[model samples]
Target: MKFSITTLSALLLVSAASVAQADSYADAIKSWCGGLAVTAPKTSTVVVAGAKTKITVTRKADERTKTITGLDLYSVSKDGKAKYVQNVWKGNYALKSSATISDAVPKNVPAGLYYYRVWVTNLIGKQHGPDCLETSRTFKVTTGSHTNAAGDLEYTESLHDNSIYNPEHEVGCFGLSVDYPKAGDTFKLNQHIHIQANRDAASQTDALTKVELYKGDQLINTAWTGSESFQNSFSLKDHLVLDNADTTSDYHYKIHATSKKADKTCVFKSGDFKISN
Candidate 1:
């Protein structure tokens, strides 16, 4: 909520010299031109324990490469200086030449240890070698709290789900859960983790999407699911925040669900859950 380190270091030096220079890499796609792939805000090291986090960056455009004429972006990080990235066609999604792009990797993220780089050239523009990649695992989203045997204190969140979804033709499965913080343990964040996907029930049946909230694996906050059909109605994970927390820290959460059906948001979700901070 504050920025001055020379305006975030001149926003990382005009985003790493504006993508180093852009010659090929589909002109470092801001839109059309084409070329970019690497599913997720993770190129390698990705470990999230909880507090609202979902960073995906999968965009593929190289059927001949060129035809976007609008919207495009993909960049992850580990201090991804190419100017602290994240641009996924804020307008929705665009880019030609055999097209392919996945968005939604920006939601109150603030833990350290990261790495990633992608390139395209139009819509949001910036191409060439930024096509870099690095991150075989080094992601954090800390926060912790656990003591539920009736001891109360049950504010938790744990991530690492890789469930690619599709149903029959795109069979991928990995699920997880440990949600129960409807509100109590000192919170002031407002709210953003109120999930209810997969079946979209009003009573209950594990339809808590994945609101997000953690300390040990670090993901400061996130509980907004107004769209994406309730953010996918529960596929990979993310969209539930009822526990409510913010004091000193509390954790003991582990809910990892993966399958992504086929990639709705599959960074790592094949099933996960644990809450004991």
Candidate 2:
């Protein structure tokens, strides 16, 4: 399945909707701020399913110290559907700048794209401000059981960081045609990337292997093998074309490998890299 990032405008609308709902309840109370503002999370986040994520909510205050009573967290799906997951925090707290809360992703959460937003309430007044809501950038949740006994894997820009293969030890490696891009490498427009993964299977029909290249939750490229497997090993490669119009920003990449058979499925993920664009 493919994934897409939620746009900033859409997130704002989602936040507004949350505040609108909260406002209806706030109107019944006497002590409620006319407006409230919150800042969204800085960047997209990725977490393993069934894990706890630390979420910080910054309430934009003008002069007075705002007393935060509680914060409600909401989860949104890839199809632009949103639901109230739970209240992460419920207590009296003063927010000079911001407050943080912890939320746990349910163990049964399906592996897919999701986003989160926060809504705050006043402790003393018991009022929820319609304007005090912020939606975070799109995030991803990966299933935790993607382990198999295929073999350990590695990636290299060239033959630089490679060791001589021994039948008793290492099984395979991946390589990129371009220089090993660092975490924050900047690239000019019109640049592109090419990568390949080479691995040896136990037998010709032992495993069905596939390689995936992702930019955040979105799957950019995939390379897979059929029922036929290499007697010793096989390789998969692909290229990614860069955009030209956007010059001030960089692009991040993550590579993952998966092998599946009738019996089981295994997965490996590489650290993220960045390219200037």
Candidate 3:
């Protein structure tokens, strides 16, 4: 069908106006969303294990109908890899001007490197909008063994001496803790001992290259390999059986790990244990 020139011109004007209206609406939505700002616990702050810490952040959105959803912690490796540790707080609270969230570092969280991030859910009309995230700077977690005059644990920043801080290495074990066979514990011969190590919040890119059992200077057996190793918890009971032949001396285990991104290998050793016939 043929259309008059005036009719076609009117249609074009209407289409152009529609496009401009849509663009304006998009810009308005973008402006409605807010940017989160973290002001406290500055970068490179040292946090003690088993201690309480506070985070302060402000929402800068034009809309004030936002809810603080979560405050989460993450473990960061030297190779710039991050893994979620735990949720310090998870709830819905109407945010006014700013808020201070408090959470204690888990006592069992091994001394390592970590950081915190805040999650906020914005309210668009009556529905919840997408979650917004603002990550804080990296922090250090110390063992917190020493105390000052007030009995508060004294925290001193550690030097970068290990693989975790080494520039040449891309991967390293953060908090390698043995779960079984405490030091000085004795196990009966022919007993099945479950050997396990917890690689606390290590990066997913890192893999266990070697897990070996040792007695003195001699190597006993390779417990697990990176190709078949567990990600967070390394356990190998089927390959580790205490026999009469293993009762000659004190025993220990070693773990070696590597990341695909680096050439350096991370090593960890367990305390001495014993086996008796």
Candidate 4:
């Protein structure tokens, strides 16, 4: 999903009903949401379904009126334009306060800063709440993140590249690990980037020569010419993103690796996985 970056301050939430009541809404967020922690996908870079995200909202009685409509995600760049990020999870609009929403990464989401806006929406646009009572959480997506794994090659998401494969800039630049994600662990696609062929693939001196993520036969995503290296520690923050997978299926990733002489294409499958929203 296309996205921008922004910091959310005092949230003035208005419901789908355009009536901003001048009444004191209790601190339902802390009351019902106290001690609530989300089981975030490891490494932040995750696949759409592989994203291990879970929220533990406390069960409270006063949190009756507050409604959690949509669980939004984004790819931010430290700017104020944090609204364009794609939404992976959209909670039930009329659900009560004690409701807990969960969803994997969205299929069509691009790379950028992501946030979760707890508010209502009408036919027009997003409804603003009376105060910033709506809870907002923020995260970023350079390559992406999710939880669990299937076999190993679960190419769930992918994006395009501009360099290596010009005939199809779509498949040349970036690759996603899984097109069909699993139930456990976190999976994510690389960002939209250009592939870089290395003069040498060893010595732990050069950056990533080539990066490609894929599904079974379908190419999920591909990217090259990264700015960092994964020789000792593989960092997903330096790659682009690509996502196109189901959150509940068992899947893995086939990271295509290339060196000076031999080109290594690694395929990873998953074990037993699941996805529920």
Q: Indicate the residue-level lDDT of 166 in model 4.
A: 22
Error of 4 at 179 (Å): 42
Q: Residues 180-218, candidate 3: write the lDDT tens digits.
A: 656887766545566676755434224567778789878
lDDT tens digits, residues 1-277, model 4? 1111221111113221321221122233234343332224322333443354553233233323444555545333322222334555555544333455665655455554344444432221353333221322233333443354664443323322212112111111112222222435454433322222221111112234344444444555443333433322332222323344465454333334332112333222223332222
Task: List ranges where model 4 is wrong by over 4 Å.
Answer: 1-52, 55-60, 63-65, 78-80, 87-98, 107-112, 120-133, 140-277
Candidate 4 achieves a global lDDT of: 0.34
lDDT scores in order: 0.32, 0.42, 0.62, 0.34
In candidate 2 the C-alpha lDDT for residue 135 amounts to 45
Candidate 1 has a TM-score of 0.21
TM-score per model over all chains = 0.21, 0.35, 0.45, 0.28
* Model 2 C-alpha RMSD to native: 21.0
Q: In candidate 2, what are the lDDT values of residues 48-74, reduced to their tens digit?
A: 667887666564455444665656544
Q: Which residue segments of model 1 deviate by more than 4 Å?
A: 1-36, 39-112, 117-182, 185-256, 259-277
Better of 1 and 2 by lDDT: 2
The residue pairs found clashing in candidate 3 are none
Query: How big is the positional error of residue 64 in model 4, measured in Å on the Cα after superposition?
Result: 3.8
Encode model 1's per-residue lDDT on 2-67: one tens digit a residue: 233564476567756543442233243234422234344332323333433333334454433222
How does candidate 3 fare on TM-score? 0.45
Measured by TM-score, the strongest candidate is: 3
